[model samples]
Target: MHDTGHNDVSPELDRRLMAAGLRLGRRNLGQTHPNPAVGALVVRHDSDGPIVVGRGWTAPGGRPHAETMALEQAGDAARGATIYTTLEPCAHDGKTPPCTDALIAAGPERVVMAIDDPDPRVSGKGRAALEAAGIVVTDGVLAKEAARDHAGHFSLVQKGRPHVTLKLAVSADGMIGRREGERMMITSKPALTAVQAMRSTSDAVVIGIGTVLIDDPRLTVRLPGLAGLSPLRVVLDPSGRLPLDSRLVTTADKVPVMAVVGPAAPANAKAALIESGVQVVETSDGPNGLNLHEALAALGEAGMTRVLVEGGARVAASLLSEDLLDEIVLFRAPVVVGPDGVRALEGYALSAIERSPRYRQIDAAIVGDDLMRRYWRD
Candidate 1:
C-alpha cells in the first residue's frame, strides 16, 4: 500500500497491466521456490491507446528478475515509458543488482505496482527510491488479486510458515474410499488431471504413513508436459514404519523424497531408509504423533513455501486439529459409499458445532461430472 505519487491514470489500464503480470508470473510457479515469481510490462502512451513495448516474467531459479529483463528489452525506448509490475522492485543487492536501480536508470515516467514486496529489506525502499528519482508511483492496484497470486511468498515472509493446502476426493456421502487397502479411482479423468496441475504448483506434497502403506503412490505429476515438474514428496512416518520398497522410496533417485520421523524411531529402520536415498529428519512428538508445527517449521527452514496435503484421514485430522490448515480443495463425485466405507476425516471429533473451524468458499466448478470446491480460512 505504499504510494510514491498519484496521477490521472486509467483504472482499466491498471487492471489490464495487473492481469498481464499475473498471467506471466504463473508460468514458473514450481520452479521458483524461495523467491517470488514476478512479471513486468513496459507501456508507452499514444493518441490512440497504450502500446506494450516489452514484457517479461521472472526467470527460472529466481535470478535476473522481471524488471531487469523487461527494461533490457525496452533499452533506450524505456525512457518516459510507464512500467507495470506485479511486485515492488527489489531495492537491495543480492545475487544481482537492485531492480530499483535498473528502473531508475531506464527513466520510466511512471511505475504502477500491484503490491509492495513484504521482504523487510525492500518493503518500502523500492518505492522510496523511485520517488526520489522523480518517478510517479502507484501501488495497491489490484492488490487482492496479486496477493492471491503470491500467497506462498507472502505466507513465508509474514507468517514464517508455508501456505498449507489440504486436497481430497470424496464420494457424495463423504466417504474417501469404499474399503480399506483398496486402490480406487474416486474422481473422474478430468478431475485427476486438474489435481495433477495443482501438484505442479506446490513446492512439496505430503502424506502420512497410512497413505504410503495403503496407496503406494508415486506422488508424481503425470500430465503430458508436467511430469518433470513434480514436487518434492514428503511422508510423515513418526515410527519409521514406511517400507523400503514403497513407491516413494523406490523413486527417490528420480524425484526427491523426505521422511519426517520422531526421535524415538528405530535406528536400524532410519539407517535403512537413508540407504534408500530418502532424506530423513527428526522432529518432536505429540500425543497424536509427530508435532506437525515443528515439522512444518523444519520445512520452512529448508525453503519450502507451499505444501499440498493429500491425506488418508489421519493426516488431515491432525493438521486440522492443530489449526495448521490454510486452504481446502474438495473434489466431490456423484457416487455414494455406504456406511461401511471409510470417512474422509478421522481422529478429530468436535464436541460442539460452534467450535468447528470456519472456511469461506472461494471457488466451485464442475470437472467431468465431479464437483471441485475450493475454500479458504475465514
Candidate 2:
C-alpha cells in the first residue's frame, strides 16, 4: 500500500519476476524464522517459453535454506536453469550444509541475487564458491525490498543477536511526562497490539532501570488468546537498583534475570530480589553505565540469540554508540514531543558516525492517533 515505486521499473515485470521468485521462497519457512527469509526460483526456457521449473525458500528449524530448498525442488530440471533468489546463496556450512554446495549440485547456468549477505561467515563466501564452481552469478536485483523483508535475519547472521530498536511515544515538543507527573499514552491501541505481536516473535524483551521505574510495564504479550505467550523479561540495572516494591520483582514467577554492572549484588538487596525469584547476575561495565556489549555477551551465554530492546533514550543511545544495536522499531504517534523531553538517540559525535545505519521499513500504518513503523537493520 505504501509507495514502493522509488525505483524505475515496470510493475508488471516486477510482479511476475517476484512471483516466480516467491514461489521458490516458501520452502524454507519453517527453518528460517529467526533467520533472513530466503526464496529461490529456477527458470528454464522451453517450447512454451520461460517457465519456472522449481522453487524453494527457508523452512522452519533453521535448515535447508532457500538455495538448498530450491535445488531439492528443481532436482534434474535445475541443470541449465537460472536461479533468482532473495539472498546470495550461503557459502559457509551452518545448520545443515552450505547453500553454495546445493547450487553447484543443481548446476544452474546463472544466478540472479537480490542482496548480498553481510554476515561475516557468508559475506562473500557464497558468491565466491559459486564463481569458483563455474556458475554465473549476477548481484543486486530488487535488493532494497528484499533486505527490508529479511532485515532481522541478516542482522542476526552478521552480529549474532537480533537488532535492538527502541520505540517510545511522547507528547508535543518532547515531554514524556506530563504536568501531573503522568506518563502520556502516545501510541494508539492498534500500535500497541502490533508491538505485542513483535514481543511474541522475539526470543527476549529487554528494558532499562529508567523504564522500569517510570512505567512498571509488565512487558508481556497480551493480545487476544495470547495472554501468557510472553517473551523473557531482561533488566539492565548496573547497581541492582530496582526497587523492592517493583512489579517485576513481585509478579514474575518465571525467575526473571537481572543484569547488574559490578561484583556481587549487595547482600540484603540480592537476598530480597532472589527471594522474590529474580536471578541476579553481576557483570563489569565497558565504560558505559552497564557495559552493554558485555551484557549482550552474557545474554549469548544464556542462550539468547535474539533480543528486542525497549527503553528510554540513554539505553538506546548507548547501544547505538557501541554498535550493539541490530535493528530499530519506531512508533511515530500524532503527538510530537518538544525539546524538554529526551531525544531518540543522544551523545554521539556526528562526524564520527559511519556505517550509515540502514533499515528496511516493515510496517507503516495509522492506529488511532499513532503511526507505527517497524524497521530492521541492513
Candidate 3:
C-alpha cells in the first residue's frame, strides 16, 4: 500500500481502506468496459475505531459511479467523514454529474484515492476540485494494484484501442492441437469453465477464419446464469472464407457478431454476411492480411474496451507480430502432443533473444490438472 503524503490517516487504516476498495471494485470486472469499475467507502471515526458509514461499487454497465452511490447512502453522515475510493472521482459529466461536486456537497473532511483516472477529461481535475473546496485529498494509495485492475479501460483511454488479451490452451509440449485431421481436447473441464468466465467479462471474443471453419465455436458464455452475458463474437476473415450458414452467423440475432474483412473480399460475401445480421467491417490490407491495427481502432470507436483473442495460430502470430497484444493467458495441460501437432503461434521470428517481446509473469495457478499462467507486457 503506497501512501500519499497528505492525510493523517494511520498507515494501517489506509491499507484496510484500500483493500476494501479493491475488493469492491473487482466485483464488477468484465461488467464495466470503457468505464473503469470503481469502489468507494465512507468511514467515520469514534472512540472504538473507524466504522464504515456507507460503501458502494460501480454498478454493471458503468452508470451511477461508486462515489455517487456511496455519498447517496451516507446522506448527512458524509459530512466530515473520510472517503476511500479505488480510483479518482470523476469531474466530467459524461453519463452522470461530476462526482467531485457530490463529494464536495457531502462535505467529506478527507478523500483518499488509489489511482488517478487516465481519461484526460478528469485526470487531475477531480482532485483539484476537491482540494479547492478545502477538503484534504490523498492519492496513490495501492495505486499499482488499482491500475492493474482497470488496465482495459485505461488502455482504451490512452491508446484509442481495446486492451487485447491472447488466450491459449496448449499441451505440455506447446501444441495447441493434434495432428492435422485429429480432434483435439487439450484442456480439462476446469480450464474450459475458466474460458467461459473470461468470455463472460470481455467486450468481444476474436478469432481467425481458420478457427471458425475448423472449430465452429459458438464463442458464447455458457456458464449457467452467465449465458446471457456472452460477449460480441468477432471473426477475422480477410478473404470472406466464413460460411453463411455457420452458427455465428445464424445466431447473430441473439448475440452480435462482427466479420472483419479486407477491401478485396468478395462483395457478394459481404452482402451475405450483412443479410445474416453480422456487422461487416472492411479494412485496409496489410502484407500478411487485413490491417489488425485498423480493425482494433474500429472496435475502439465502437466502444469496445477489452478483447479476448482465442486463436488458431495465424491470428495469434499476427497480433503478436504487430505488438498489439497486452496480456496473455496460457492454460497448459499435462498431456504432451508431438511435433506434428499444430503450434500455438506461427510466423513470428526474432534474430536475437533480446529483440523478442518480454512479459512479466503476473500469476500462476492450477485448475484441475491444468496450469493457468497470466502475463502482461513488460
- Runs of candidate 2 with Cα error greater than 4 angstroms are 1-35, 43-55, 73-77, 147-162, 178-184, 200-203, 224-232, 241-261, 267-281, 286-288, 300-306, 320-329, 335-365, 372-378
Give the clashing residue pairs of candidate 1, or none: none
TM-score of each prediction: 0.95, 0.69, 0.94
Model 3 scores a C-alpha lDDT of: 0.86
Q: What residue pairs clash in candidate 3, if any at all? A: none
What are the Cα lDDT values of the candidates?
0.85, 0.65, 0.86
* Rank order (by lDDT, best first): 3, 1, 2
lDDT of 2: 0.65
Number of the top-ranking candidate, with TM-score as the measure: 1
Error of 1 at 305 (Å): 0.6
Error of 3 at 245 (Å): 1.5
Better of 1 and 2 by lDDT: 1
